[model samples]
Target: MNSSPSVKIVSKCFVKPKTILEESKKPYYLSPWDFAMLSVHYIQKGLLFQKPLHSTDTLLDKLRESLAIALVHFYPLAGRLSAQINENTKSYSVFVDCSNSPGAGFIYATSEAVNHDGRTMSLLTVQVTELVDGIFIGLSINHAMGDGTSFWNFFSAWSEIFQAQESNKTDELYLKNPPVLKRYIPQGYGPLFSLPYSHPDEFIRTYESPILKERIFCFSSETIRLLKAKINQVCGTTSISSFQSLTAVIWRCITRARRLPIERETSCRLAADNRGRMYPPLPRDYFGNCLSALRTAAKAGVLLENDLGWAALKVHQAVADHTSEKVTIMIDQWLKSPFIYHIDRLFEPMSVMMGSSPRFDKYGCEFGMGKALTLRSGYAHKFDGKVSAYPGREGGGSIDLEVCLVPQFMEALESDEEFMSLVYF
Candidate 1:
C-alpha cells in the first residue's frame, strides 16, 4: 500500500436550499414505505475522484453552490425529522420538517499529502476531502429520507449542476429526471398514522456489532457473461439472469467460507425495487424508500452441496415470484400489521443481503472531476453479511460487489480459491 498524507479540515459550513418549501408541504408526511425504515441507520457512501486542476476553494464553492440549487428540487435534504407520539395508539409518528433550518453539511478538508451522527442532525451531510492525488466525498443521509436510488439521483443531479457551472453553461443545465417527492401512501391511510413503536428509540435495533472487514470484488463483463452462461447451461434453462447467477456464486462461496454448521439455514436477501411493481406503477426516479427486501434460504449443507446452477435457479425463482400482485398484498398486510424494519426484523445469522444495484449510475456524477477513481462506503448498515453492489468504474457489463463480513470470514473468503478465481479482481 502507498503511504498517504493525512488530511486536515480547512472549513465547515451549512448550505441551505436556494428555495423554501411551501407551507402546505411543511410537515411533509412520511409514507408507510418511508416509515418502515425509521429503525435503520443513516446511509453512508463516498465518491472518489482524481484531483482536478481547479483550486480547492473554487472546487468547494462550486460544489456547495450547486448543492444549494439542487436542494430546491430535493428540499427534504434541508430539513430534519419531527416525531410525535400518538396518544391513543401509543406509537410514534414521524415526518420531515421541511423548514429552512440546518441544511446539508459541507466540509472541506485537504491532505498535505494526504487523507470523516445521526439523529437530531441535518437529514443529509456531505463532506468533500481533497486527497494528495484525489478527492473523496462522504455522504450520510437519513434512511427514512430515501433509498439508494434517491441517494444517487440527488448526487448525480448535484454534480450535473456543478459541471454546468464549471463550464459556464449553468443556463443550459437541467435535471433530466427530477426527484418525484410524492410519498407512496397506501389507500385509506392517513398522513397521521403512527408506527407500532411508542417512542422513536423503540424502533432502533441494537446488537453487539462485531469488528468487521470488507473487500470489493470486481466482476468483469466477460466473467459475468460466462458465469451467467455457464450456470444456465448447467441448469438446462436460460431463465437465470446475470444478477441471479452472480448472486448465487457469492452466496455459495460465502457459505462455504463461513464454515457454518451444515444444518444451519443460510439466507440470501435482495432489495427488490418496487417502482415497477407498484399497482399503478411509479416513475423510474420516484424518490424515497420504494423497495422490498426479498429473501430465500437453504440449509448451509444443502447450499454447498448444490451446483452453482442449482443455487442460481433458487434465487431466480424468488425474483420471479415477486410480482405486482404480491407487492400489493405485502403492503396491504403491512397496513394491518404495521411493523417497522428494525435490525432484528431484517437481519440474522449467516444471512447475506444484496443492496444497492449494478444499475445505479455510479460514475455519471462528473462534477468536473476527470473521472471517479473508486467508490468508498462509511460505517452505516455494515452488518457482517451486508453486500452492496455497484456498476464497475470502467462501466461495461462489469460490476463491483462491496462485501462486508466478520473479520474471520473475510479472511477465509480472501483465500478461498474457488471464489477468487471466478472474480476478475
Candidate 2:
C-alpha cells in the first residue's frame, strides 16, 4: 500500500449558494429515504490528478468558484435541515430550508503523501487529506439531501463546471439535465416523514457503533470471470452476473471468517437503486432518496456449507425479486412507518450494509485535471459488516470493494486463503 503524505488543515468554511432562490423555492420536504438519513453525513473523497498544480491558493480558489456555480443548480444542498412539529400528533417532519440559510462545508488541507487510498481513512470519523502535488476533496453532505445517485449528480455537475472553466469554455458550460425536484408520494398514501417515530434522534439510536477497521480489496477481471464461470458450471445456469458471483463469494467468505455460530441467521442488506424500477420510472436526474433495500438471509451453516454457486443463487434471487410492484409496495410500507428500519441489527455481527453500485462510473469523475486517483467514503459505513463495491479503475470488467469489519474478523479475512487469492492489497 502507498503511504499518504502528512496533511495539515489550511482552512474550513461553508460555501454558500452564489444565486438566490425565489420565495416559492424556500422549503422542500425530504422523501422517506432522505428522511431516514437525517442524522448522518454522506462523506465522499476524490483525488485530483497527481501532477503538481500552480499553487494551493490557485487550486482552492478554483474549487470554491466552481462549487458556488454548482450550488446554483443544487441550491437545496446549500440549505439547512429543519423540522416542523404537529401539535395534534406531537410529531415533527424534517424539511430542507432552502432559503440560502447555510452552505455546504469545505476544507482545505495538504498531505505529505502522494496518494490517499482507503488505508489512510480514519476508523473514528470522516477525514480528507491532500498532497502538495494533488488535492483530495472531501464532501460531507447531510444524508437527508440525497442518496449516492444524487451525490454523484451534484458532483458530476461540479466537475462539468470545473472542466469548462479549466478549459476556458465557461460559456458552453450548461447542464444537460437539471435536477428534478418534484416530490413523489404514492396515491392514497399519507406523508412519509411523520414525526415522533421518524424523529432524527430516534433513528440515530439504531446502528451507532464504535470504531471499526476498513480496507479496500481489488479483484481483477480474470478472477471475477473465473468465479462466475465456476458458479455457473456448478449451478448449470448462465443467468448469474459478475456482480452476483462476486457478492456471493465475498458474503460467504466473510461469514466463514467470522466463524459465527453455525445456526445463527446472517443477512446481507443490498441497497437497491429504484431509479427505473418505478412504474413510469423517475427522471434521469431525479434528485432525492429513491432507494429500496433488498435483503437475503440464511443460516451461517447453510451459507458456508453449500457450494459457492448455491450462495450465488440466493443473491441472484434476491435481486430478481425486486420488481416494479414490489418497489411501489415498499413505498407504501415506508409511508406507513418511514422511520423504522430495524437497523439496530445492522450494528450486530450477522448483518452487512452493501452500498455503492458498479453501474455508476466512479472512475470517470473528472475535475478538469484528470480522472480521480481513487474515490472512497470518508468514514467506515458498518462496524462489522459493510461492503461498498465499485468498478475497478483498471476498467476491464473488474471490481473493487471497501470492506469494514470487526478487528478480529478483519484479521481472519486477511488470512483467508480463498478470499486473499483474488484480492489485491
Candidate 3:
C-alpha cells in the first residue's frame, strides 16, 4: 500500500457568483428526493492532469474566473444552506439560501495528494492542488444539491466555459443542456414537510472512518463483452448486461476475500438513478437528488456456491425491479417516517455498495491540461465495501473499478486468481 500523502493549504476563499439573479433572495425549496440526502456525506471526486505550461498565476486566475461564471448558471450552488426548526411539529426544513451569499469555496493548496477529504460544510467546494508533475482539481459537492448526473453536468459546463476562453466565446457561451431548477416532490406528498430532525448536522453524524486500503483495477472492453456473453450463456438469459456481469464478479471476489461466515448475510447496494425510471420520466438533464439504493442480498454460502451467472442474474433482477412504482413508493415511505443513513450503514459485514457509475463522462472535463491522466475519488462516502466505477481514460468502452477494503481483504483480492486475471493493471 502507498503511504498517505500530506497536504498544506495555501489559500482558501469563497467565490461568489459572477452575476446575481433577478430574484436574488428566492429560496430553492428542498424536494423529497433532495431532503432524503441531508444526512449523507458529500460527493468527493477529483481529476489528475499533467503539468500545464501556464504559470500558477494564470492558472489560478482562469480557474477562479471560470468557476464564478459557472455559478452564474448554477446559482444555487453559490448559496448557503438554511435550516429552520418548527418546535411544535418537532421537525425542520432545509433549503439553499440564494440571498446575499458567500458562494462556493475556492481552495488553492500544494500537495502530493490528489484526493481531498470531504470535510467542508460548504455546498460547493473545490480544491486546486498544484502537484510536482500535475495539477489535481478536487471537488466536494453536497449530495443534496444533485446526483451523479448533475455533478458531471456542472463539471462539463465549467470545463466548456474554460476551454472557450482562448476562442474568446465566453460572452456568448450558453449551457447546451442547462440544469432543470425545478425540485422533484412526489405527488400528494407536498411542497414542504416538517422533517423528523432538529438540525441537519444532527442527522448527518460524524464518526472516524476505519483504516482501509484502496486499489484501482481496470477491465478491458473485450474482456467485459466476453464475460457478459459467458454469463448470459450459463444463465440462459441474454438480458444480463456488461455492467451486471462486472459487478457480479467483483461482489463475489470481495465476499471470498472477506472470509465471512458461511451463513452470513451478504449484500450489494447499487445507487440506481430514478430519472429514466420515473413515469413520464424526468428530463435526462433534471438536476437534484433522484437516486435510490437498490440493495440485493444472499447468504454467504449460497453466494459462494453459486456460479457467476447466478450472481449476475441477481444484479440484473435488481435493476429490472427498480421501476417507477418503486421510486414513488420509496418517496412515499420516506415522507411517512424520515430517516438518515449514517456512514456505518454502508460498512456492514460481507457487504458491497456501488457508487458513481461508468456512464458518467469522467474524462470529458478537460481544462486545457489535455485529457485527464485518470479519474480518482476523495475520502468521503468511502468505506471498506464501497466501490466506485469510472470509464477508462483510454475510452473504448473500458471500465475502471476503484475498490476500497480492509488491508487484509485487499491483499486477498490482489491474490485471487479469477479476480486478477481480468485486471489490466
Highest TM-score scorer: 3
lDDT of 3 at 215: 92
What's every prediction's RMSD, in angstroms?
A: 4.1, 5.6, 3.2
| For model 2, the run of ten residues with the poorest summed lDDT | 114-123
| lDDT of candidate 3 over 116-146, digit per residue (tens) | 1122245888888888999988777887888
**Local accuracy of candidate 2 as per-residue lDDT tens digits, 1-425:** 11234445557666766767684266676676665554443445454465435665776687788888888788777766566666677676666666635466665532212011111221011123456566566554455566778777777788788777787886667886678876665666445466564334555543355667889899999988988899999999999999889888789989988898998999877888888888999887898888876889899999988988998899999999999999878777767665544445434566766787776766666765577777666542455688988888888888889898888888999999989998865
Q: Residues 1-425, candidate 1, lDDT per residue (tens digit)?
A: 11124545677889888766575257778777877777666777778988888797888888888998888888888877777777578877777777646777776531111000233677887878776898887677787888899999988888888877777886666688888987888777877667776665555665345688988999898888899999999999999999899999889989998999999999999999989988799898888888898889999999999888889988999999999999898888878988777665578888999999999897888878866889887666778888999999888789899999998899999998888997874
Regions of model 2 farther than 4 Å from truth: 1-8, 48-51, 109-128, 188-193, 197-208, 340-343, 346-348
lDDT of 3: 0.81
Error of 2 at 144 (Å): 1.2
Model 1, residue pairs in steric clash: 5-114, 7-115, 113-132
TM-score of 2: 0.87
Residue 87 of model 3 has an lDDT of 70
Global lDDT of each candidate: 0.80, 0.69, 0.81
Q: What lDDT does model 1 reach? A: 0.80
